[model samples]
Target: TMTIANSIPSEENNEYCNQFHSKYEPKEILGRGLSSVVRRCVEKSSKTEFAVKVIDLNNLDTNSEDARQDALKELRILRLVQGHANIILLHDHFETEAYIFFVFEICPHGELFEHLNKVVRMSEKRTRGVMRQLLDALEFLHSRQIVHRDIKAENILLDAEMSVKLTDFGFATEVETDDCLTDLCGTPSYLSPEILVVNMYESRSIRVYGRPVDMWASGVLMYTLLVGSPPFWHRRQMTMLRMIMEGRFSLDTPEWEEVSEAAKSLIASLLRVDPGQRLTSVQALAHPFFAKQELPCVTFDRRTRFRSAILAVRCLCRLHRAYAMPARLELRRLRADPYTIRNMRRLIDNTAFLVYSHWVKKAEDQNRAALFENSPKMDLAAQDSG
Candidate 1:
């Protein structure tokens, strides 16, 4: 039984900090920034792992009041977007006199930025999968009128399976339908032209710039994922801002030669100078680029069911052997019989062939069906047959 303390009153805040430590054993620091450090923690009772972000209130670099407010704002936004699949889960939070702790679901693989650093670049298939999850999370946020003002690679975390878990809502804010956000926030390379225009020239010409800013950041992220570098980056900060403002990024680079035109087109649409002309989250999700890159949907039939049953039985058999053979000597003495091994190998080969065959057949069928449905001749043939 975990006691979830939503918030501790100012008077009892210090006392609750002890309670948090009692419930969870804080471990090694996972990451660190100027204002905060995230550490791995394990709940005492259940031993479930979590990530705890501890924000220092006494840091002279940042105003204590503003830091506290930012922490509270992140808590509110995390709660608002709770249960979203692609967004990071906030299990609990605690605030003390000197620190505020945010307990989140542990993403063992760390930030997308770190992953991209290692891989340098991702294949179109991998990029599409990452983009899809990111866009879905963004769409979920936008639906609730919440803008994730910061959507850089550093803020995006990855779980064990490499699924996107969007985090760091410190800059997130809820906007009404007609509201215009003038805040010049987010990473420099990922910031939209509208934000830069306002930031540099203090221009009031861009009357509306809220959710579209997120779209622009997402576009930058996609470009980064595909090309291994930000599209608008420059050696100098001012030069980078100028490039972003002028929309001077080029797809003519050698890195982009292998990228599909559909992807380039979507990036262009998202990075449009006019925020109004930029694709919304929902529209971006519907882009042809993703459609082309997505894997074919798998439909389970009798053969798949049979193959699953065989695999399940094999797993059970392995479990049975494990339970029955505690001693290494006994396990070595009663090894898998030749008959059993042969049958297992045959079953695995058959299963693989059947699964591959089924997938190829399904994809071909889907493509043929799509073509036929779109053809006027097929429609006339149906009419004649009727």
Candidate 2:
């Protein structure tokens, strides 16, 4: 590795790059995705580590504007919602004519999906605890008029302490609470029924979709966590859409046998087909599902060879949904990114590290104070109390 420069003296560094090379040296790559890659980097001055999300604008899938906008949207959204504990911090942003760089806090534990792969099933206590943090972050985003169109296990990052930090706001958008957005965004399986055109098969009309989409995805994530698979997973897009529009997911899986009724109820309300009927972030927090639960460890009753085989297959199918959207099409009204053989290998091989540290009891006082120090806690607290 080249030595960290004493100073990066260049015209663009003076304008776009934020003393980048002079202060930090790029290290090993941490993760990869469709159009971007994250690298582990360290600050020479402080020896502090961070993840630099690098996007090469030229290679950023030119077929559609959504691919490029996802990058810009992430930057804008990060600027808007940076202080929440459960949201990843964007320490700095740098740009050149051909590239955009986002300096984020190092999430050594990669993603929640990787963690689940190892632990198999999470106990209700752990799942509820995570839901609290996830909802806390979601509540803040919704209050700021921002909707994180993408909410999945891979997009969520984990710090060393196991604190859930929602990441990847590339598809996020800000809109008025009462208005509707007409974009078909987010991963296929995690998408809410309200946004799909086919959902209005009987009475076709453009509908304004909004925050409830994230709530629906949260339901998918919650169900995936408890049962080891997504509520919506199928081979083809139309097949998946049909199941999603019909709300064909159920809590009848064998793994859900030991799961609680209250948890199932929350998932039902979140995965509602009608946006008007879905739970808001605040309402989800107050639901009985997030209430304190006893017996802190999760138990997966089936470890038989057959069950393992089924889980492995389901896991691959779940991963496919992330990259299943086709790349380009001349659909009458809508445009989509071309889907060649782009993410075929990722499904069979990709496993993000989802490890996180349980909040240390020794620093309980400090951690608790820091949790809401600069966050939008009062709004939710007041609403819950009322």
lDDT of 1: 0.76
Compose the digit string of candidate 2's lDDT tens values, residues 1-386.
63212122344455443557666788877777655677888978889999888776666547435555667777888999989999999987776665678999998888887786666457888899888899999999999999998998878888999989999887888888734687677777788887885345557553678888899999999987875657776646688788998899878744466788999999999999888889999999999987755886766576676798999999999879866975553432121221122242122212221222243122213221122123122243345568
Q: Evaluate residue 376 in candidate 2 and report its C-alpha lDDT on the 0 to 100 scale.
A: 20
RMSD (Cα, Å) for all candidates, in order, is: 18.7, 19.4
**Each candidate's TM vs. the true structure?**
0.71, 0.70
Indicate the residue-level lDDT of 247 in model 2. 93
Worst 10 residues of 1 by lDDT: 367-376
Which clashing pairs does model 1 show? none
- Backbone-clash count (model 2): 12
Stretches of candidate 2 exceeding 4 Å from the true structure: 2-18, 63-70, 198-206, 293-386
TM-score of 2: 0.70
How far in Å is the alpha carbon of 34 misplaced in model 1? 1.1
- Clashes in each model (backbone N, CA, C under 3 Å)? 0, 12
